[model samples]
Target: MPANHRYSARTAFLLLACTVLASCGGMGGSSINPVNWVTPYKIDVIQGNFVSKEQVEQLKAGMTRDQVKATLGTPLMASLFHADRWDYVFTLKRQGVEPQSYKYTVFFKNDQLERFEGDAMPSETEFIAKLGKRRKLGDVPVLEATEAQLKAAEKPKSATASAAVPASVPAGAPPASYPPLESAKQ
Candidate 1:
């Protein structure tokens, strides 16, 4: 190839590469990017302690820390600096749905639960319902066979067979016994 043609080709390739890279760089934060339109699958992220309303309701003013822990698994955040305070935090992040976060704080005095407060905790059923996706079901088809179809499916018995014998063993045959798995000692 001529020197000029080779130089031109090199320049064109360099320009193409730069353009492609620039386009990709621009797409990182742009809403119009192809990736933005078709999002990659993101698994549901569930984090921290999930304290239900029932569990919180079980908490009493004089209940011990162990009792509180028993009712509501374990505290997600327990700081050494704040020995008397235990924080229970729950966060759920799922694609195509708003993220959910709930925080509950328990204060203890003399190793006994003094008071507890935080965001209104959801019932177990309510939390479960939020996690599940409800899809509209299509009309179901009839599953049971019609009487005519059942009659058509019946097989005619063979003339030579007096009775249907069990597939594994004959009706009158005794059950076969197996030897002991271990050998008898001398």
Candidate 2:
């Protein structure tokens, strides 16, 4: 074959192969590209009671175990073997965000809170903010009906006004005042 003709045939084959590969990129199924769609939904797992800083700060060295329970709610782990120790653990696992775990221990000596230890606690507002709460930008609208409007709405409407009988109503039965049915003479 002539050199020029051979080069042309090779170019045509290469062009066809390039077009086929380019079409694959637009396919809906898994493409040759490395990119993947991010998951739209992820469950937020919360295993234990969330303890705030204020609740922890309320604890005093002499407070009774019952008071501690009331202030911090029930402990996540209260073992039978360790009667004096109460452990409160909080864990949150959210998608695309780092998991968080907090541990607090309370020791009771004669049913009184002897001491408590844990990491630095977050306040109610701080914790809420950290959980990705959107702050209100402006005053919220208060929607309420006036007395007259409420009374009008509360008034019973006539059956004829609806003009549509419910399907539950039986087809039988004419009024007692209606004339009695009699057979006509043939």
Candidate 3:
């Protein structure tokens, strides 16, 4: 036989052997495709957020557990030992981002927030109430001053520093609005 024919025959035999081995190994039923798995999949996890101190401060220490529940919705991880202790635990993990988003824990002692162990606790609640949704990075105010702002602010303090003007009151702004109102007829 020609050398080329022998080479072709060997290739054919190798392919046939592979096909037989594949069938025995359940290749037809298997869904593991190497080409499909080659590319790395980007896993994105958008975790929900929490409330802030101001929003939760309205919740008093003596307030019933129900009231707290009503105000803050529900705790994420309740104590298995006692129902009274409520733990609002938040844990987030991103692949290449910061090691973590700050863990916010609101521990309620006898249904009232006992100790604010984390800075993230207060902001989460207030953020939710203010935005009518959980807080995101955009919701959280950024304090990192831009280069221009830093330069402007860094300028020597003017002897006549600009007065810290109060916010502008809009038209029809009330002097002091309260719940109780005197009848105009009276």
What TM-score, over all chains together, does every model reach? Answer: 0.58, 0.57, 0.36
Residue-level lDDT tens digits of model 1 in 126-184: 98887766434687899999999999999887855645565678768986897799999
- Poorest lDDT segment (10 consecutive residues) of candidate 3: 126-135
What lDDT does the true structure give each of the candidates?
A: 0.88, 0.84, 0.58
Q: What's the count of clashing pairs in each model shown?
A: 0, 0, 11
> Who wins the TM-score comparison?
1
Quote the lDDT for 151 in model 1.
90
Q: What global local distance difference test value does model 2 have?
A: 0.84
Residue 22 C-alpha lDDT in model 3:
67
Clashing pairs in 1: none
Local accuracy of candidate 3 as per-residue lDDT tens digits, 56-164: 5666556666776777667666678765566555445444444334344445565655543444454555534633433255566787999999898886855454344
**Stronger candidate by TM-score (1 vs 3):** 1
Candidate 2 lDDT, tens digit per residue, 65-124? 889989999999999999999999999988777898999899999998899999788998
Error of 2 at 54 (Å): 0.8
